[model samples]
Each structure stands twice: as structure tokens, then as C-alpha cells.
Target: MPEIRNILFVMYDQLRHDYMSCAGHPTMRTPNFDRLAAKGVRFTQAYVQSPVCGASRMSYYTGRYVGSHGAAWNGYPLKVGEATMGDHLRKLGMDSWLLGKTHMTPDTEGMARLGLTRDSVIGARVAECGFDLWVREDGLNPEGPDGFYYATPSPYNEYLKSLGYPGENPWHDNANAGVDEDGSVASGWLMKNARKGANVKEEHSETPWLTDRCLDFLASPQAAERPWLAHLSYIKPHWPYIAPEPYASMYGPQDVVPANRTEAEREDPQPVYGAFMNNLIGKAFSRDEVRSEVVPAYMGLIAQCDDQFGRLLDHLESTGRMEDTMIVLTADHGDYMGDHWMGEKDLFHDCSVRVPLIIYDPRQSAGSTRGTTCDALVESIDLTATFIEAAGGEVPEHVVEGRSLMPFLRGDTPAEWRDVAISEYDYSCSVMAGKLGVAPKDAVLFMIFDGRWKMMHAEGGFRPMLFDTLNDPKELDDRGDDPACAETRARLMERLSAWSRRVSQRTTISSDQIIARRGKARSKGVYLGVYDENDLTPELLVPITGAAKGDFR
Candidate 1:
């Protein structure tokens, strides 16, 4: 077995797979991200369970689908009792720690119902999505007329105060918003001001601040003896669309590639897709001006993220931890960046659901696959199973719906692998649902992509979307209404129906334990059935035959 000691699992928010140089972006280069890919295996087609933040991260942390975990959207609580990657790693004497955002809302109601107090260890772990938080910052500290996004104080805000940014909400002014000549706050939330840079210093920015915290935790003297799974989750490259000084101006509109949309998409859009296109954010991204301003800022934030990766890699190498540690660099989900007539990650487009996944395992077993690329269909939840397997533990398949990628990392491919990639979106409470006149439960969408064909099934009596990726790779054309594609759509729908019928969440106990219990029940004269006399042991047969006849009379 490969001797892996630690896990450096890194996640970037709202990073599209195609944005990285390693993944074939035309202009935006990410050398540090490419460096890790060259030293490891880069997955060409890794997708998240959901396109949004909270639901996607919950799927990743728990190795379960959004429907399974029941945390369907942002601000939705993950119901207590779902086992997470941290919970599984603990069984093998490993500690899982979080250095940054999880986007988790504690299941306060579930805890209350179960009488799990906040002071209790089990309660705290359940509330934290099963990881010990080293420093928790969801990074969206937007302050509005109502209040800050999160009502509580932020450590990032506290750090800004220490740096002489005196304000009630310096996070908005110094970090997320820019200052005008008149000393007015140009909030980054405004799409018009996306071209502007942030007021904070690059070193004090969210990305670098979170990276510094990780470095400090790794360098601490009182580190735990058990192997550690440090989740260095960054909230950058997601929003505010602003970077500090040098990174802010690193790229211009000229550096941005053209948007991946066409007039054809708007000609006769799907009812559900059209409703989303009319959304405020989507309409803004469709305009040439908004794309010109925001794409560069988006690239700048990504550039800063890449630079931080370089710093982290240098530290690990200098400390001689590179060889013993397994580093996984991936994003929670991708951003639209004006693709498919969308602005954010709410649809099933590759720009929204597909994410970059790079894994660097230092074991000699991984040598053969170095600098390689795997085209296998992968899910974000697979990382949970991979982490458990790498730490010398068996994957609880009853709980985890994803397969491990260890075989691929070790230069081997499993004889059988999933041919389709699945992604789901719950838009019941979204603005799109209101525009489409659909109930919340009827606004759900599930995508089934079988490498070449992509089919989307929407609830609320919406027409299913069919795209022949082999022909219309850009997904500019929807063939759901095309009679010629009926068979293809039917086949994919059947596959999706079969997938949904899987027996998920049935593994609270091991198969061995279930079998042992069967034997124990049989020993207590509880026989389910017997087809023949040979089916029963002599002791069990004796009573039925004649041994107890006189006693019964």
C-alpha cells in the first residue's frame, strides 16, 4: 500500500474548469495550477453534484448527493446524522481540519430536536459539517440596508480593524468595495463597478489571508500526531469580482475570450432556460459592456489564487512535506462567466457544473500516472471516498454514493466505470421559478451527460432539454423538441430513472454485522423459512420432526 501521511485538500470557489491554463483556456494562464497538474493526474471531466455553493460543498464533504444529504441550497441546513469525510477519517486515526469556508448552516432545529447542545462535542462537530474549524470565513460579508450577510462579526473584519481600517463594516469598504474620489463606497456587488479594483492590500485580501492561516496552522508546534486532512478552502475567484492593485490590473478586456453564447440560444429558448436568461444577473452578463468589465476582474481574482497556490507549494516543498502529503486542488463548482445565457452557476452547462480537479499523490504507486490526464467521468463526492481509502480505511459504500479514484491515481483503470456524469439543481425557491410560474418542488432539474449526449429533465411540466454534444459541442442548439432525437432522449431518461432508484443511505451497519445478526436470530429459533429439511440444522429439525412430540402433548 502507498504510504500517505497527510492530505492538503484545496478548494477554490466559482472557478470554471476551462479557466485554468492546464485545462486549455486561451488567454488566462494559471501556471501554479498547471504545475500541480503536471506533477499529478488532472481530471478532464470532473463535475460537482450541484452548481451552487452550499449544496455543492455539502455533497463534497459528505460524499452524498444533494437529495441524500437534504441540504439543497444555500442557507439550508444539513440535517444532523449524515456522516462526513471528517467523520470517516476519524475512524482511521486522522484529523480533518478546515482552514476556510464551508458555506454550512448549522442544523439548529435538528440539534434542538435531538437535545444536542452547542457545548457538546458531538453537537459542535455536527454543526460544523464534521470538520474542526481552524478559522471559518464564508467570505461573503456583504453589508446591505438590512445588515451584513452574516449577522455575526467576522475574523477578516477583525483583522482589517487591527490594520487601521476603522469602520463598522470595513469588510465591505476595504475588502469587497472600492472607494471613489468623493470617498463613496463603490460596492463590488454592482456589475457596473466590476472593472474597478478593491481598496484592500493584496496581502490582506481574502485569498492570501486564508492561505497565511493555513501556513501558520501547518507550522504550529502543537500539531496532532495523527495524520491531518487540512481543507484549505478559499472563497476567492468567486465574487466581488475585484482583486487588489497588481492582480486587479493584471488582465484587461482584451485578455478575455469571447462569451460562449449565441443569438441562436435566444431565438427560441427552452421555457425554463429562457426564464433564467431573463434574470437580472443573466441579462447583465449577456450585455457586451458587463462582460468586458467583469471577465477581467474574474481573471484577476483567479490569477491571485494561482499565485497563492505557488506560495503554498513552495512552503510544502521547503518543509519537505510535499512527498508525504497528498494534495488535491479542485473547485466547488464553476462560474458561467457569460456562458449559455447565464451569469452564475445555476444551470447544467459545462461552464457552471464542470470543475477542475487535480490530485497529487506522492506515493511511488502514483509515479506511472504523473503528468497524465484522465477522461473518466468523475463527481465531487468521489474525493470523500478517495480520502478515506488513501488513509487506509474502507469506503462505506452504503453511505457514499461516489466511487474512489485510487485506481486511476495508481496508473490503473477499473474494468468498469461510470459512463455518465450526473448533476442536480434545486431552483424551487429561485427567481426563475417565480418567472416560470412553478412551485418550489417543481423547479428542480437533473442533468445526465454520457460524454457525448447531454439531457436535462426539468420538473414543473417543462420540456426535457437534449443536446448532441458530439455535434453541437457549444450547446447552442437544444434538440429536445426535435423528433429525430427522441430515442436518444428516451435512453438517457431511462438511465437517469435507473440511477434515482439506487438504494442510497442504507449502510449504517456493515454487511458483516447484518449477516451476524441473522445467525444470532436463527440461534434463538427465529427461522425465516425453510424450503427443505436440508435447509435446517439437525437441532432445528429435531423439534419439528419428533424429538419434542411427547413434550408438546
Candidate 2:
């Protein structure tokens, strides 16, 4: 057999596509990611099949829709017999290993035979997802001694704690707080452990540790022989946005903070956890400090990740693996950061759903396709198929509904890609209502983004949101009812309805004798929110009594 060239998958949890400099956001400092974009292909309209973590990742690993794999939410796991990306790679005689956080299953064995036991921590997920090396902490955030807030003082936590402003007592250090507006007082504790002299693994935080692992993988005997897939997942910039020295002081809150929201955008429905968003703005710091400072700190975290990636790239070149390897970079989902007055994802919106996707392939249809950007709609589901193709394996017939993005990446044929992207979110909001003994009135919502227009439809609510993305890029106005775009609205409704039917059917395995040989599993995709089709577009909602019996499109 020919020598196996490794593939690298770098995922940043909750990173929005538009926030990175390579994605064309002018201010964010992401030289490393931007450089990857420059050397390879950037997807302009990439989206995830589901907004939530486990579901979107399931789609990525299986190349199947969330409706196909049983893992649907953060709490869900891969159903027995479902194939993962690693499983497919292993079948092709390649050794597949998982190093970091595997939320679907807490252990490395959760998916396939590979590296390391599962710690299920954010740091570990980063290591296992793409990196061949491993050092991780699984389980929830460690509790503080006083029980007032979450803290991790494990040997790992102690190392991280050492990075904060020196205090004889770590608890007295005010780690959870942020810097004052003038950058005088400290707020929360810094997460990068090895930065200090404290004893910790080389791969820690969102950058240094992750890059170090990548370099290690490249220099090891494995790089000299076999093809490997390394995932370096970063937990920073997600929340508690506490960065250290240079990163913390690199930018000001006013310099890069997001713009204020208008009343119209704020009027939209607030997720039940409204207090978290409020606290993000001002509670962490004293008066004179608005929430804007967090942006620079967040950007600093991004820069840190970028710097680490630059180092990894240099190592790959030094090891002579750059030409033979393929690099894929993306994120599981996105964070709102105050967009729509929300902090964490689980809401259905572009801010929470669209993620940065970049693919760097050594083989090109035309030499030097640097900085090539494709606007063709792409989703995370397509990743499994792309990887399978790159690794010389046939993409299983029933694996995923997503098509390979290679055509778009090569820029040789743009006509083959999908014209629109779809997004779905499982509603924790509705579930909490039921838990609180309240009526769950809202049905789950689904969105379809055609090139020119974006339509948001909720099953329970009749209010449909239509945004002419070209005119209102911020998506501030809901024009679903505008009479001028009735035809466009009707077309989008059909598309949305058809999509629902398709995924719903594929949610389960076929009982056919042929399919049985392939060992398929039933899907556990979560459906959230409630909507009235008539309210959004009466023409599209049909008078039905039960479930959709077959494909509607």
C-alpha cells in the first residue's frame, strides 16, 4: 500500500463564521486561521445541520443528518451500531484515534478503536477531536471550596489557578471576575495553565496546548509513516472570556466590542435565560465598565488560537507533511455574545448556527488556488463524505444527504453544490417550560437560507421571519408578511416543508433487506419549537390531521 498521508481536523467550539478575520471580519485578529483561508478554500455560507453541539457533531462524524444518527443533543449519545468518521477510517486500514472531548460518548471507545480514554472535558474534546495526542479532564467544572461558583483546582486546575494574579489564597484572587474598564482591577481567573510555572500538560487552554499537541503528532513516528487525523478543539471564547496578559491587554472593550442593539432587534423573543445575557454586559465588572471589554478579550483568545495554529503549520512544513496532508478547520456551532440578547447557543439564529469552515487540500485542479472562497451553501454533514473521499474510501450510500464540497473548493464547478443551507435547533426553552409545569406552547422552528433570502419558520408560532439578507444583512427586519415578496415566500415555504419531510424520513433506518446488511440505526434527532404554517405562509401549510406520511416536496 502507498504511504498514508494524515488529515487534520481543527474544530473550535462555538465559533461564529463571521467573527474571524479570514471570514472577512475586518477587526478580529486571526492571522493563523486567516492564513489557512489564504492557502485553501473558505466556505462563505457554511452552516450546521443542527445548532446544538452533539447533534451537529454527530452529523459531521456520520455524514448523516441528525435525524439519521441517534445523538441529538448535548445529553444524547451515539446509538449502538451507528458508524462514526473514525469507524469508517478504521475500516480503510487507517488507525483512527480520538484524543479530546467526545461528548457523544464520554470515553474514546464511544466511537471506534483509537487513542486515549474519554475525559469529556472541553480541553480533552479539543485533543481527541483532531489531535493524535491526548491529555484531558472529563466531567463537569470542578466546584469551588466555598460552593459559590464552579472551579477546577484539580492538579490541572491548580496549574491554571497559578496563572492568575498571585494570591496566597487562590479563592481570594477573584478569578470569575473580569478586568475593570480601565484594565486596572482583575475579574475572572485565567485558564491557560502552562503559561505559569505550575505543573500541567503541554496542551492546555485554547491555543498553546492545542498547537503543541499538533507539533508533537507531526514529529512522532506516526507522521513518518501513517496518515492521521488530529483535532485540536478550543474551549476559549465560548464564555467566561478570561484571557491572559498579552491577549487580555491586546484590545480594548471599546475597540472591538459589538455594536449596541436597537429596540426592534431586542423586541424579538428572549430565551428563558435572559439573566445570563444581562450579566455578560455589566455584572462582572464595577461601574464604568460596560460589557464591551469582553470582545477584545474574546479576540485575544482567538488570536492565541491563531498563533498556536501558525506554529502547527510551521511544524507540519518542517516535518515535510504539508504537501501530503489535508487540513480541515471549522467549529461545532456559534455563540451569540449578546446578539439577540443571548449568550449561549440553542436558539435558532444565524449568529448561533453559522460556523467558519475552511478546507486546505494539497491537490488542486489548478495550481495555487489560494484565497479561493466559495459561496455555495455547505453544512457540517458534508464533512464525513469529504473526509471519506479524501481518505480513498467510498462515501457510504446512506451515510449522509450532504454532497462533497470538493467541487466548490476546487472552484472548477460551482453548479454542483446546494443552492441553500438549512438549520435546526432543539428547544431547551420549551423543555424547561414543561419542567416548570407550564404549557409548552411553542413548536420547534426550522430555517432555510437561500442565496438571496432567509426564511425562519416556527411550527407553533404563526409568525414567519423573512429577511432579504442582501438588504438587511443584520437580519433586523422580519418581512415574512411583506406583500412584495409573496412569491419568494411561497417558494421558501415549499423548500422548508420539503426539507422537513426528507430529514424526518431519513431519521430512521429502512427495514429493507439490502439496508439491513449495512447495519443502520434509528435516529434520535430532537425537534423543538411550535409553529403554524398558515401564519407564516398559508399557501404552504396543508390541512393535515396527523404526521407527514411521505416526502412532501
lDDT of 1 by residue, 71-104 (tens): 9999999988889999999889888898889999
Task: Estimate the lDDT of model 1.
Answer: 0.89
- In lDDT terms, how accurate is model 2? 0.61
- The TM-score of predicted model 1 comes to 0.96
Return the lDDT, model 2, position 283. 25
- Candidate 2 error regions (>4 Å): 1-4, 106-133, 136-206, 257-260, 268-289, 364-368, 429-443, 481-487, 503-553
Candidate with top lDDT is: 1
TM-score of each: 0.96, 0.74
User: Please, what is the whole-model Cα lDDT of each candidate in the order they appear?
Assistant: 0.89, 0.61
